[model samples]
Target: MIRLAGLAVAPWLLWPLLGAFIGLMPAPAGADDTASSPATLLPAPVAPVPPLLDRQQVDAAIGRLDGIVDAAMAKTAIPGVAVAVVYKDEILYAKGFGLREVGQPEPVDMDTVFLLASVSKPITSTILARLVGDKLFDWDDPVRGHDPSFALSDPYVTENATFADLLSHRSGLNTGAGDLLEDLGFDRETILSRLDQQPLDPFRSTYHYSNYGYTAGAVAAAKAAGEPFEDIAERVLFEPLGMSRSSYRHTDYLGHANRARIHVRVGDPAERRWEARYDRMPDAQAPAGGASGSISDLARYLRLQLRDGSFEGEPIVDAGALATTHLPHIAGRLPADPTERAGFYGLGWNVGYDDLGRVTLGHSGAFVLGTSTAILLLPGEELGIAAITNGEPIGVPEAIGSTFMDIAQHGEQTVDWLSFIGGFFAHEFAVDPAGPDYAEPPASAEPPRADDAYAGTYDNSYYGPLVVETEGGALSMKLGPADAPKRFPLTPYDGDVFTFEPIGENAAPLSAAQFRTGDDGGIASVTLEFYDRTGLGTFTRN
Candidate 1:
């Protein structure tokens, strides 16, 4: 799992995109070449090689889905889940389980919309693939050619990075760069404009999963199409595929009548109580993590992917162009142990090879505020499954998809996948107990300076101006855009160090604001620990 600004991105979610199947070695020379030999000697008719899983095996797997989903929900206590499985050209199963909300009477059905989270990455790639087929722009074309405003800290990278480079997360931006700005109420344009301020890793040689970096590529693609990404998605892919219920706009999701309300676990960690919260708004990075749709709508998408960019006997996107989106463009995860397999990332999907050397494409999506979604495709078998859950990620969707794939290929699950995956999620989301207990201050702690001394305007190029003001004898800090700054009331932890509870999706529970003094014994700078991921959280006192 990747942790940025205290937000945990599921490890599986970090994997993305697809690639071509590993081909068989060619037959020895002089085997059967009718063209080189006499016309009378014809080669024997060859039988078609069977698929990895037969119809009977697929049917048997579909039969066990109900039990798999039922047991997962019962154990996790998630509010709702919608799952759809597509095999060949048919929808093998599409169903929804549990309530739309824990306390609501409306039950989740096949049409119930849920946020797709990072699963939107593949959908974005699909739309771009359509544009590529139309000759709008090639995947390797430099992004600046399409959008003049696009840039990174490194001028060379800014001018040379391609759509494929950014989409595969190899442009070298720090992991989750620009995400904190989004959490701080910064809009898309503001966030995009500020990405040049972020530090890079090692140009195209580094793989750091960045949402805004991916969004930058999508935004550039939209510019090349001369339309917003949402409109392009509908015009190029959604409408053509008859996915009327799918949308990249957060407003459309909110307007949906049967949408699953996002639910997060509240109360003690052991208690596991859930509460519905309408807080996450991912429109800023829509191309990377903002998509909402139903299982029925996603089933069609799986069919298109399995059929190589074709849907319902019609080619919506060019097969060659779409295949580019699945080819491994960069190594995403290197195995820590010899037994584990290395993972690769393509345009917007995770590419991996199974034991049989068959290509497996998958990506997991999650919002800690409450949604979890996953899609896994076995292209060799023409089988794929998509699952969306309306609850905080506890590995429910991934587990469901894993269980289904196991049953499809092996005829039975090899292990308790839910427990195995859920344990990782639990550990990732667990609060770190190493930090200081802000609620209890040490009796020997030194007192803070006068409120007026700390009350001043501070400036940071990356995060903008931060204003510390004295309010009713207490100090408070405001940071973000001037119009809508987020205010955090400061509570003194020690001399010159105050603690405040950070807010928003990427916020840490408690962050310290340490005031630095100059030779004059006056505040010179303030350092915010939570906003310092790239070492740019310090603000000079103005």
Candidate 2:
């Protein structure tokens, strides 16, 4: 639960940005490309978005979020979208807009189903929580003890880490050393064997996002409960929460005829929209993120969490467990002003914070062209928000998320749509011609040499193994098990500063990377902050 203040574009991050590139920023990318907007396949917007809550104040709040949503879409490259808000047991807001399938021209509505991606974690966590309550397994169970099939390159973490450790991301498993990405064609057993090569960091310190880890834990839960992951989910979550329209298994949606299409954020309006899929998980990883449902159905589930883990007079997770689950874990900090940090991870949700630092437990997901989200407040208020889209939008999930809280917690109105987005890209990500980044100093622009200084295996649980190389007078971004390492021609921008230009087609262009020199005056860990992704990480010499 990295705080939203750090990640969401705000007034402060927008000012200088607009001043820098409002007039000269690159023309929106071609559709289907993240760097640009869509080129074709534009779908018609849905009929007027239907309202869920009628409160003027609530509408004002929803409007603020909607504005951000519109802008966020422009940045993220999303197509159609559906959103729902719930308070207590009452539906507050529900709306639909954009196309459902880019190739096809259908609109989206409440019943449209999209891949849940990581948003599936909380629901999976809720089910496992019920299993824990049922004495099926203990949170303390060593993950491997419950399912010996679980293995990683790091033997110590493999044997010592428990279910709790896995949930907390302290298992130290670097990204996907097990070759899950490459083995998209393999079955469960085939992929799990690659674990021996993936190293884990020392366990129990910080939160590391790992799809493989969560999927593995989910598989273990399924094994422990003696049921298929989907079955267990149906019995424990979907049914009780009345997410009847939801399914763990994939399906082509026929309901809620008006659904948003998936679009590549190629920066244009004309582009093809299509469905995308997730090929990883469940050698047994159902527990991390593997479920989908309508926005309304997810809202019901959120209402349950908002009501202290109960909904419609039924307790999904007891209040005591709810408290424990919602409590913060992992010093989980997103980059932002320390004073404004506003969220943390609690069990499975990415909880948000406000000016008061209160908890707003929520979660969001992004897989291919689609993004899913569920955000709710559980303290003094019981506001909940959920959205599902077939195609990914530029940061729409977060935009919608923050606006929900601002309205729910503070009664703020939605900002002006076009203006906000106009301001947003202008501020947060724009590269300034005269800014400090361009003015910084680096040790030398002379091509970095391969002085053993660039040799080491850097491991990040979320990013996996990266082999740094000094090849042909340049650095290499050898993302092991992720297709191939793309080479970069490093150009120093400032002090130990550099930018990475990917080689070959579809290679990222002109992204920033910064380095730290070791005591001996050679580069140590080079921490990179790239555009359009989660936290940037280190690539140690391997």
- Which candidate ranks first by lDDT, i.e. highest? 1
Each model's Cα RMSD = 7.7, 13.6
Model 2 agreement with the true structure over 89-180: per-residue lDDT tens digits: 67777776666665566666666666565677777777777777677776667778778888776677777666656654556665433323
Count of clashing pairs, candidate 1: 6
Provide the lDDT at 502 for model 1: 79
lDDT of 1: 0.82
**CA lDDT, every model vs. true structure:** 0.82, 0.53
Question: Which window of 10 residues has the lowest lDDT sum in candidate 2?
Answer: 20-29
Identify the runs in model 2 with alpha carbons over 4 angstroms from their true place: 1-56, 59-78, 103-105, 176-184, 251-261, 267-286, 334-343, 372-378, 413-542
